[model samples]
Target: MPLGPPVPERAQRLLAQLERYGSREHGQLAVGRRLLAEHPDLPLDGFMISSSMCPEPGRPLHSLILRVGEHDTDGITAWARALATEPIIDGARHQLDTILDDIGIWASATISEADYDMDQAVFIPSGDDVSFTHRGLLVTEFGEDGDLLFSGHPPAREVLAATSAYYRDTCGQRLRAFDGRDLADSITRGWCRFVAYPTRTDWRIRSASQDTPGALPVTWMYAQEGDTQDLGDPVHCPACGRSSRGLDYDHVTGQRVHLCPSPVCRHQWPVDDAPDLEATEHRQDQRAALAAH
Candidate 1:
């Protein structure tokens, strides 16, 4: 049986094609390029590294992979290192603290080396493997995959169980596990990241933390309210086509916050360079359409 959720048709077809490359003369080269072309939802906007060392040298490997969309990667790196050195319970709390609001999909796995090899061989373009260790708790980057954005593959059921044990040793608990065979599963489940209120009951994917509420919805919180802080020009929201003369512009953060007047499209976001909101929204629509299939 296929592991985890069913791989999307397009991804499954591409994966089959990628598998063929494993036997080609180049031997798994260009898999990442091909995958990115076929699936743009990858690099997952943002994610956190859930690291676990190999429990059994020969069996499948497991790790926690949380989809923390668009959070600063450097921040996560610093936090992961710091948590690794802290006491076990503290480390666990630290992980939750960093990602509780941003996290979308909480998936752990125990995937066969062969399966991971298949995904990595195609996804990782090239790089020397780097291992991260803190206080003897070992965590490593997923692979030499070309694009680090979507680096690791989800673990199989068995790999997840083994990984839970490893995570328990390293961080004090095992996350709810899923059996994801390829990157397609990751993309499918990742749709929740964009949703306002995500529900895990309908799918195999589960929340990483006990908190049932979804991540903070995207919004433009007012920074300053006085006339000095107000933007002079009538700015319009590209997403909703609403126009307003007064908007909050924070000099300290170097950000201009705008909230759409449209009730149906109460879109809020910061404007730094007069972002092409229409274009961005179009692209997101395209991605959602693709995922629906």
Candidate 2:
């Protein structure tokens, strides 16, 4: 007796064809590439193939699931139907049709617009370690306990490029790229450090203090009236007397201030109090001119 429902004759034939095709080296890759080439308009994220054999004596059933963007359901279905009739191999027109007969092909709309949002790329620092996430999906994580975890694949190249552009243009921050697990381990060990800009191509890395090079400066702050200070310039904390180059903004005493980068210092100074080097130099020149006169 077959387990569950008896496999239909067409399904059996399809399964047999799939098994035969999959036995060839790089067969699955070839199919995926063909699908991608045929449907250039389709936003194909990826795909999966699975086979199952159930019941006491049953023919193996194979399934091909295509992951795509949500709005392309009808388009994907139409393409699949066309693929069934299309001659994939040059001399064998019936081969592909026979294999597609009653084949378990499914389209899943898993990729969304938000998945490519550059703003969704964020780095969360926790104690001595940090984690990088895009659209709430963990890309890579460095644990304080010296544990490292990575999401199977890096973010898409376009997504990473968009994120890099966003940080550089919108956030007014510079980015450095780090690839592979070895550099990530170096970060945890303090041999090097990097900002959480998403890139898979570059392998360059650099080291700096907590708020020095390769750090994202906090640029979000509500400006009070008549406050024309350029927050992009580094400020020195009066209390700590340390430069606030990569430090974040803080609200203290009902005004925007530069939070000292030093964890031990924890000092804040009013934004207006930050020295204007240009203005000071201009004033000095005026005084010198008056004395010359």
Candidate 3:
């Protein structure tokens, strides 16, 4: 018996294909990838979402996996924070404070198709992972294999309330408890995280904190990566990973901020640059300019 809301037409077709997997769970892997590809919509334009799904019909469990991008987190937090101060928000004020506590790992909000504006102020992430500990509650969560984790019950608002305090106090640290258990223990413990949604096979999770430790406060650190000087062309847009004459050159930095030619992308290059590259250029430019002098 497939559970949760009516499976989307696309999903139903995909599931049919996997029905024969040992004749029970056929399209589990494809479903997992689709989960990442088909994410729910957020309120704003600058948000992105990805997810993975695992099905264990034998155990009667279906888990939907989601990974929030950094920008979406920031947008949600900012919206939540603005809503906090308004009257009659009923704990919205508190929710904003909690979101601010660990803005990176615990900043999030969900609106039920209402035009209500928020007095709370949450600063959403632009270049990081999902903010808020559980900003991830599903409006309707379901596994491709036909399992339901949460939806329309206890309402997303209530779950936020239950987790608000714990996340609010953590301060840039993430508190992951699955199926009502601590995250670390879930990873190390017996089948707990797996049970959070009623699951059975191939469930794994990794935290952003693990990758970058020793962070400061109010959100430890932004992700940093080394650049390849072989960026090909410095004048091309660093954003779409494309290079074209259509770029915005920073007068101050003399660096290119490429704009995507595609109307859909409309993305601008990131302001950050390689400190190493800058230094190298500065030295080389000095020698050339000195020779000219």
RMSD of each: 24.8, 21.7, 24.3
lDDT values of the candidates?
0.33, 0.40, 0.32
Full candidate order by lDDT, most accurate first: 2, 1, 3
TM-score per prediction, in order, is 0.15, 0.21, 0.16
For candidate 3, the C-alpha RMSD (Å) to the true structure equals 24.3
Question: In candidate 1, which residue ranges exceed 4 Å CA deviation?
Answer: 1-130, 134-137, 142-267, 277-284, 287-293
lDDT of 1 by residue, 1-293 (tens): 13234655555554454444342233221322332344444332222233235444432222223333232333334434433332112111222222221221132222222322221221112122223332322223232321111112233332333333434454453232121123222221121111111111111111222233432111111111112212334578878677854344332342455656677876656756674455456556656798999
Q: Write the per-residue lDDT of candidate 2 for residues 1-293, one digit (tens) a residue.
A: 12124444443433345445463242443454445445555545556665566612433255555555554544554555666543222111111222332334455332232343323323333333323444543332233332233222333443344344434454465333221112122221232333232321211123434455443322111111112223466578788788764322332123344567689987866557665455456556656798999
Candidate 2 backbone collisions, by pair = none
- List runs of model 3 lying over 4 Å from the truth: 1-54, 58-117, 120-283, 289-293
lDDT of 3 by residue, 130-172 (tens): 2233444332122332112322134434443423333334323
Model 1's TM-score against the true structure: 0.15
